[model samples]
Target: MTARIGVVTFPGSLDDRDTQRAIRVAGAEPVALWHKDKDLKQVDAVVLCGGFSYGDYLRAGAIARFSPVMDTLIDQAKAGLPVLGICNGFQILTEAHLLPGGMLGNDHLHFICRDQKLRVENAGTAWTSDYSAGQEIHIPLKNMDGRYVADPRTLDELEAEGRVAFRYLDVNPNGSLNDIAGITNAAGNVVGLMPHPEHAVEPLIGTGRTDGLPFFTSILKKLVNA
Candidate 1:
């Protein structure tokens, strides 16, 4: 059966359509999910696309963390449902406590937009299985509150357990602790990242690089095997 991937669109979301397209490009069915709706439409997996949800009110994704959809998402994720969060979506995951750490303002205090370099730190997660550990890829990074912060113990645990799925390479765009660009939950089913993979899935667009396609394909493979 073809995998059905849901893309959630919260208020002020700007990349839901792009995420859907990337899912389709990866040969999966794209399902649109609303932030206020509890129904998942039977999607095999979910992606929280990047955007300034709630206009970044009350700090980045703070307000959106309590959305009705997240109520279900949090439960499902704990039950082994595969989920990926990008940019502001990453912020929401942290706020909901589905993932560790928090996203703070960039150290430079600027909304940065650039093609970023990252190293795949973990290859066993549901969303990163297709990538080899240490593989370098480029994806677009754009946001203001993009710096990832966590306590020293949490950072150590993440690193020791191989939950750090991606690490910034070359230049650290937002001064994220330990150069973390993305991380996976202990179960490895949930992943969140600062860069926008949906924006990098097509070779004819943006940076003309398709390095981000592996993320969608990785989940599709996981669903098929499951």
Candidate 2:
């Protein structure tokens, strides 16, 4: 059966359509989910698309974390449902305590937008299985509070357990601790990253690079084999 992937559209979300398109391009059915809805439509996985959710009030993603959908998402995620959070969605994941750490202001104290290079550190996660360890890919990055910070022990734990799924390459765009660009939960079912993979899935579009397509494909492969 073809995988059905849900893309959640919180208020201020900018990439929900693109994410759904990417899922469809990957040979999966794209289901649109709303922030206020409790039902998931039985999607095999979920993607929290990026944007300035809730206008970034009280910190990015702070308000959206309490959305009705998140209540269900949190429970399902703990039960082994796969989730991928990108950009502002990453912030929400952290705020919801689904992922670790907090997103702080960029070290430069400015909104940044650029094509970023990242190294795949963990290829075994539900969202990254299509990548190979140490492989490098370029994706777009944009955000003001994009820096990732965590206590020393937590950082150590993430590194030691191979939970650091992606690391910035060449240059750190946001001064994230340990140059971490993304991380996965211990179960490998929840993954969050600052870079915008949904924006890079089509080669004919921005940057003409399709490096981000694997994220969708990886989940499709997992669901098919399951």
Q: Which candidate is the best by lDDT?
A: 2
lDDT of 1 by residue, 132-198 (tens): 9999999999999989999999999998998999999999999899999999999999999999889
Report per-prediction Cα RMSD to one decimal: 0.7, 0.7
TM-score of each model, paired residue for residue: 0.98, 0.99
Look at candidate 2 and give me any clashing residue pairs: none
Worst 10 residues of 2 by lDDT: 198-207
Q: What are the runs in model 1 whose C-alpha is more than 4 Å off? A: none
Q: Please give the CA lDDT of all the candidate structures.
A: 0.93, 0.95
User: Can you tell me which runs of candidate 2 are displaced by over 4 Å?
Assistant: none
